[model samples]
Target chain A: MGFFTKLLETSRVKSPWIVHFDCGSCNGCDIEILACLTPIYDVERFGILNIGNPKHADILIVSGTVNHRNAKVLRNVYDQMPEPRAVIAIGACGTSGGIFREAYNVVGGVDKVIPVDVYVPGCPAKPEAIIDGVVLALGKLKEQRTAKDTDSLAAELHQAREFYANRADRQVVE
Target chain B: MSTIIPFGPQHPVLPEPLHLKITLKDEIVTDAIPMLGYVHRGLETLVSIKDLDQMVQVVERVCGICSCIHAHTYCMCVEGILGIEIPKRAEFLRIIWSELHRMHSHLLWLGLLADAFGMESLFMHCWRIRERVMDVMEATAGNRVIISINKVGGVRRDLSPDQLRWIAQVLDELERELDAIKPVLTNDYTVKKRTVGVGVLTKEQAYELGAVGPTLRGSGVAQDVRMTGYGAYKFIDFEPVVEKDGDSYARTMVRFRELYQAIDIVRQLIRKLPDGELSVKVKAAKPEGEIVCRSEQPRGELLYYVKGNGSKFLERVRIRTPTFANVPPLLAMLPGIEMADVPVVALSIDPCISCTER
Candidate 1:
């Protein structure tokens, strides 16, 4: 709705600095993402840079099944990124835990950790779908300017700390 | 000041998840501690529930890039369980497919390493060659990746004469082009400065840490899983590739030589292929026993331990990926290295966190 907001959204669409994280995935999805960055797909031409630091990233691309052990670390990373941030769950495992859902260690899906803006579904979602999901995230970022003004990630992080501190409260009151 | 840095269990650069606590004293690694058990999916459990027929698919999905090798190794284990002899044609095809996967995987590693160092154009060029390998995978397996071609007794897909010839020809081109490109990777001042002499893993250190694949090969060891002669490896002749320097450059050179070796092995396989049944009808029942079979993945030696109950489901499955073996070495090497050199040194072991985690 605002001038700088519109400009930032447009630039974000054109220049998405992505930080890719692997919660726990078979490299199938990781390699496909690598393919998109390579010359054959060349998603980088659109200025989708893979940044090493999470603090500066606008798009968070995650692959693999989120396991119980990594759920906290995943939330912590999602909390670290600045506002106007978007999460793209890449691969079947990331979206819904895929083949490994029934396993004891599997965490079911990435959304269980944080809200996902887009989901690219495939055993190993092809590079093209990954790009499309990113494009969709940018569009959503533009539309959500006035939808929710609060910093949800920070709030979630705060809530998480409380949930852990009062672990005894989870037991039966009776 | 002593600084602590965490690597993986969830981090960039590793497709798998292994938590490494690295301690550095002003850029020199002082000590490294590794924490594992992240991607443990109870693969052994799945193997028991599924018959040999179905487990073939499961093994291939274990790691996408190395799908063919897992399938091949599983096939070897199964053939051992049942007294079945694979046809020479099937054996040749298996070898050809494995080598192609190696070529593609090594190139993928080369590009990522280059990209890590901020060599954008060079990275792009390496991946362009990778596309050719993917094309071959697509043409044969009907999937660019996760080929899913390896089956119980033999391969699921049969290679036509034209496909075989095309594969050999394509590999020839890739070999030539990759050879010409070697100078750029080796001679370039930046790559040398970034990689050479950094992350030096002495031969004894490598052995002590249980390093495998090019990581071990770089440390002056001549060990490779292929020497075990699983699949069609017995028929197709090849030698273990090694470099004595035990630095990042030596590791790079090992991959380079192995790439050419992979090409040659494929060419010989296609030429010597004896025609017959590509896949035999597999009877899957709860076989009573446990077995372990492994092969050299692009990263290193990968072992799959399977324990099967008399029931349809597997009792236990444990995978020891090469990345796990290299972790201790990585921790050892990480200390005494500059912060800037961490990724380069880390990647030199070709970390596949997913495989480790899984």
Candidate 2:
């Protein structure tokens, strides 16, 4: 790898700016995500900061299930992030929709609309578990950088958009 | 020029997903429209999907900050429909846990409030103290955020005298820390300047808008659902904290005083802890009635309506959360405030979007 490429990889690992999105959660996972930033869990120690803007984020942490109303918005957020981005699905709801999967409005988990690299599973997912998920995402980021899989990533994003648009359209039809 | 600025669905000040469309005339907000349904998971509709007995887990997850009280109220409602009386000891245990939940929630809110106003150290201090409350919760109920202890007839777990003593020690430590920080939140000049007279909701306005919890109490309305005394609260003696200022500062003061009130409530519950069964032997009979249950949450009063149809599944379950009730008053507070103070005034109501949309 080139020296500049190596430096860029190391910088991404050192400082992963995260954007947290609440798709349709119970606030269980959302509070736990905030708890990760506080002194006790302090994910910032790992150089992870929760930013509010998707344009500036390298990691996307989503809590809760994706519903028909939010599926397109979630897809739009994923598409806004720059390449080599990793998505971390936090909590059981985000991972597999949890108990809300059967609800009429829900379209299941974050993976329903985007490609999730790390799945942190808990009712709210412990702060420790979330920190571990970020670390795992860093590894995924390195792998994605090495493979230079922008084409496949683009394809995946395209597929996700189409799927959600269809889901929204189906909801309207019903 | 009047400019329309979208405040959120995603914003730094709001930790949750809430969208506000604020129309600005120069620096002052002319009109503010809040758009809901961002985090609507349709949880209330899951009553038919999950059985009545298993629905306690679903209700508890409605909002992590007040999970214990949610479950407590749901179980109380179900027990009411089934006509079963919970043991006195169980009632006291419920109070202790619920009070602990309220303390952690208020501390979390205080930290968020400090962050909203750019007081970083104060935010850290509030969260640092909040961790102690979480530790106490984990020690007693085995989970920090969602203490899934309540069941249909009563609570699921029993605390020993030794565990009770340990919780008391933690509460004592927390009270000392809160006493040290209370002054900074209540009397600090910057806090007062930013909050005082920023979002004044007159007593009449608060009543007409259906504000509950600290939002109502801050407006000089001494009404609290705890006064209804569902559980062991009936035996406890403590007055609701009321401030007549009806601004952001008043709301902060109400929550600050409530921290002590929660601690005192927990202590009283422990001292008056009775001896009996942890839960009654709930009979297996399909409930055939409808009941509405109300409980005081850290944010405000939460109402749950359950309709049973003599089957395992419930007919309908509706939840009216405090944030939903406070949103109208929040809109009323925003129009006259400066653009920069939008977050501070919004945070004052402690809007839990997930709770509101759920």
Interface Cα root-mean-square deviation for all models: 9.1, 7.6
lDDT of 2 by residue, B297-333 (tens): 9999999998999998899889999999999999999
- lDDT for each residue of candidate 2 in A16-135, tens digit (9 for 90 to 100): 999988888877788788888888888888888988888789999999899887787788788878778999998889999998889888899899899999999988788889998999
TM-score of each: 0.91, 0.94
- Candidate 2 ranges beyond 4 A from true positions: A149-174
Question: On a 0 to 100 scale, what is the lDDT of residue A60 in model 1?
Answer: 86
| lDDT, model 2, position B272 | 90
Error of 2 at B40 (Å): 0.8
Predicted complex 2: DockQ: 0.38
Looking at chain B only, the TM-scores across the models are 0.93, 0.99
Lowest lDDT 10-mer window, candidate 1 chain B? B40-49
